[model samples]
Target: MLNRIETYYDAVPRSSARAEEFGPLTLFVQEGQGWPYYARPALGHEGDVPVAAVEKVRARQRELGVPEAFEWVAETTPGLRAAVEATGLTVHEHPLMVLEGEPLPVPEPEGFTVRLVGADDAALDTAVAAPFAAFDAPVAPGTSARVADRITAGLTRLAAALDATGSAHAAGQHQPVGTVTEVVGVGTVPAARRQGLGLAVTAALVADARAHGTELVFLTASDADVARLYGRLGFRTIATALIAEA
Candidate 1:
């Protein structure tokens, strides 16, 4: 399962980025304007990674003007967290979850509809930008416009929970590699929390993945508490996902 997850990780960035090797680390460089991909332990490379190797990867990331970020499965690369932290980077741990049971039914908020967002959808901007705001990232100018291109290319699929006024209050996306898909960036606006808008968006993405022939779905929750929320959708923690940023 770890190998399969690593393959999915390696493939998700290929549609928009190219991989560069730095020892056991692979830096995924964005080929055009879009969110920058981060560095990760190369597929199949496991065990203790040296701090020097991590330092080299960060140096290259700085040179390329990309985020000095790293993500890896804790069990797959147990020593990577220490090596990354030795470089003065801060690391965060998340629940690495996979869908192992049926998605429990979740109801949408009142007057809200959840569905996939199309390339030409007029609500694309709001849908795409919702996650950024939900995650507390400043919605910089034109930061999410490439979502349209991504949708058109079938590289990703976005789903949103929209109000009767036709505005998105929650959004998420699933990037697929064959029958396996990874759900990412699913969130609801601060004003919409506790109303099940975020849960509805996630359920929609999970359903869409199955409709498109996806056989596996997984994601990393921000924390243990949040993992319990995703548990409502039948996702269970299988490992700890470690992320480091300099």
Candidate 2:
């Protein structure tokens, strides 16, 4: 199962770059093209093996516009940590949690409902772009605009992919309080925060994934507080992925 977990992510790669398989080993370029992110490897298989593997992936990541990446060393396999460190890549430790057993409590807002998002739903489209509305902070105009553009573009692309893969959903009336796409983006309007809207939309998506026969649903959240909400819905941390500028 551990081995399969790595392969599952390798299969997706977050980008369009092809994943290469070499016996029990696999390599690929990460998508969304950025830094301080992971270049994952399965547990065990240490020493010269991962060194050679990283060399191969490093070249591939470079070709895909990434100069640096980290490997996710499972707590169960700390030996792989030493191997990764020896390969000249800095390593960090983080917990990997998983929620099993019964389903979590799925709460909905007083007057809203969770349902599938149509491609033409303006509320869903606006909620999808809500994250970008926070782009302008302590940063300058161009900085926020560029980041916001990337985020909007990424969400648009993801919405298209989810529709293609059959997993886009929306919540609320003509104007939604939140939106969620697969195991990806989940957000609500400022006025609607803490109203259980995010959890409701997320639960709907999880139900969709389970109905489709997917055993696991995962996501990476930079904010620990928001992650706690997901934790309540049976999403375990698994890993903390850090991102840095390229």
Candidate 3:
């Protein structure tokens, strides 16, 4: 399962956008997207990458003008965390989770419905904007256009939760949530959270993935509470994710 998840993550940037190789690392770069974080360093199961290899990864990120960041499964790449940290980068650890068995039936919460909007510009705008508002962060310029590129590339399926009046209250995407189908970008507006909209949208995506023959679904939660929330829907922690950022 971890191997599959790792493969999925490695394939995402390669499949949808531009992927460049630097020795043992793969760099995903999507320029002009305003979402600098989208440009990532993907290190797979290459065990104990040499310090020079790590420097090359950082050099490539600098050349691409993207943030210096990479995510890897520590167990898969032994000593990688120490190597990255020695170079003045910070490593953050989190659970790498996967959905197990059958997902519980997630009925649409009352007064809300899940909508599959695909890549429609207007609908995408609402879907993209809701998270920024919910998190109280400025909507980075050009993010919508970058996301649209991914959607139009047939790389993402966008979903959202709407109120009775049809206003988008929360949104998310079901993409190769790493190398397998997984739900991501699940977020609810402050006004709409705690009412089960997040679960509703996620469940909708899970059902859609299963219907399309995707058997194993996976995602990385922001924290334990989010993990626990998905746990109720059948996701289980399978490994730990180590992320290094400069």
Candidate 4:
């Protein structure tokens, strides 16, 4: 399962980013409209990685004006954490979770409807802005070329909880590659949180993935508490997901 998950990790970014090799690391660089990417242990690589190699990847990220970030599974790349820490970066640990069986049924909480967000939906921009608001990111910029285009093409799937006004209160997405899909960016706006909106949106994504033949679904939670929330949706922690950012 871990190998399959790792392979999916290596495959998803390749569809939308350029992979730059740095010894044992592969930095995924996205030059266009997609979200920023990061470095990870080169696919199939094993054993210790020299600190100097990590330094070079960081230097290249700096040169490209991208985030100096690296992500990997702790059990698969045990030596990377120490090298990342040696560079004075902050490393965070997240629970690497996988769906064990059918997800627990999550009925739409009162006052919100959860469904897949269509590319040309009238409230598309509002849907895009929802997660940004939930994460307290800068006000979401105007939507021009949206990830929803990819959703429409079947490359990705976005689910959101919308109020009566058709504006999103919570949103999340999953990207399917073959039989695997990774659930990411699940969040609910502060004012709308604690209403079960996050779980509803996530459940929508999971159901959609399963209905479409996606065989593996997984995510990395922000913390133990967040992991427990996902557990309610039937996800189980399988490993530690690590991220180091400068």
For each candidate, C-alpha RMSD in Å?
A: 1.3, 8.7, 2.6, 1.3
Candidate 2 clashing pairs? Answer: 14-31, 15-31, 35-244, 97-238
Per-residue lDDT for 3-27 in model 2, tens only? 4444445444444444555333455
Tens digits of per-residue lDDT for model 3 on 1-246? 767766777776555357777666677776444554432335443556667778887887888777888788766776677778888898888877888887987778888778776666456787878777877888888777767877887677777887666677988888855237867778888987898888888888788787767878888888888889999899899888887887
Better of 2 and 3 by TM-score: 3
> lDDT tens digits, residues 78-191, model 4?
999999999888999999999989999877799888998888887677767788888888653434255766777777788889999998889888999999999998888899
TM-score of each: 0.96, 0.57, 0.88, 0.96
Model 2 earns a TM-score of 0.57
Worst 10 residues of 2 by lDDT: 172-181
The runs of at least 3 residues in candidate 1 whose Cα sits more than 4 Å from the true structure, single-residue gaps closed, are: none
Best model number under lDDT: 4
The lDDT for every candidate, in the order shown, is: 0.88, 0.47, 0.75, 0.89
Model 4 regions lying over 4 Å from their true place: 139-144
lDDT of 4: 0.89
Task: Sort every candidate by lDDT, greatest first.
Answer: 4, 1, 3, 2
Cα error, candidate 4, residue 74 (Å)? 0.3
Q: Residue 20 of model 2: what lDDT? A: 55
lDDT of 4 at 195: 93
